[model samples]
Target: MRSIISFLTMIMLSGCGDGVTLYPAKGTILLENGNPVTQGTIECESVDNPKKLNASASIQKDGSFELETMGNKGIVAGRHKVTLIGPAGNSDLPLNKQPKPQFNTKYRSYDTSDLTITISPNATNNLNLKVVPAK
Candidate 1:
């Protein structure tokens, strides 16, 4: 069981002095072709309770990210619906110079994404997830 509880967008932090330590979850995001996803945000939402505060992270240039819950970086012990939204690409560019969507709409939300992740009470959870572009 997780020591933390999340409701709506509110996060409550707790811990067990009995010895179970909850650690943060980290992962790397990559395109199906094995290239790094330069910019974007990743989400990890509780499966049973969609309203629970969702854990989110900024996708780094190396395609890596760490999930944050209750102000700390980690999720409670349970299943999570993972979602990734790639940056619109070249956001720094002029409006007309922005690039098209790098991935399909399905990759943008937990409800539509096929990605699911499980978090444990381990010291570290490093998931290597992959995303693909749709035709």
Candidate 2:
């Protein structure tokens, strides 16, 4: 009985991922001044679907990033809203005690951010995102 239960669990776990297709995506983030944003996270949420399809990645020191979707190395091909988040001030501090983001807050929200991108199928999508700096 235990072995049968384990087999059933494995079958269920294997089917957890939906059948959404993903395309390879890579990109860089820079400020409007053309300087790379040193450290942050970037997320792209699908605007064409209501299924919460999204991809995200960490911005490297040189501002380069490769997006991943649910552990897959790409995003679903479609229009997506982009949002960026700066690194935390200090890891030792609590959330409230940490300093606010050094970049403009507008880039942190999908609704408020003007950034958008369209990912195409059968191609490696290379994106270049630029946003305003903090005042």
Which candidate number has the best lDDT?
A: 2
lDDT of each: 0.73, 0.84
Q: Can you give the TM-score per candidate against the true fold? A: 0.72, 0.80
Cα lDDT tens digits, model 2, 23-132, are 88998888889888878899999988679787899988888999998777888888999998888679899988875554698888998999999999966788988878
Least lDDT summed over 10 consecutive residues: which range in candidate 1? 8-17
Candidate 1 lDDT, 16-133, residue by residue in tens: 2233334688889888899877777888877754455578888888988988865666776678888776665665799888755555679777778999888877546888988886
Q: Report the CA-based lDDT of candidate 2 relative to the real structure.
A: 0.84
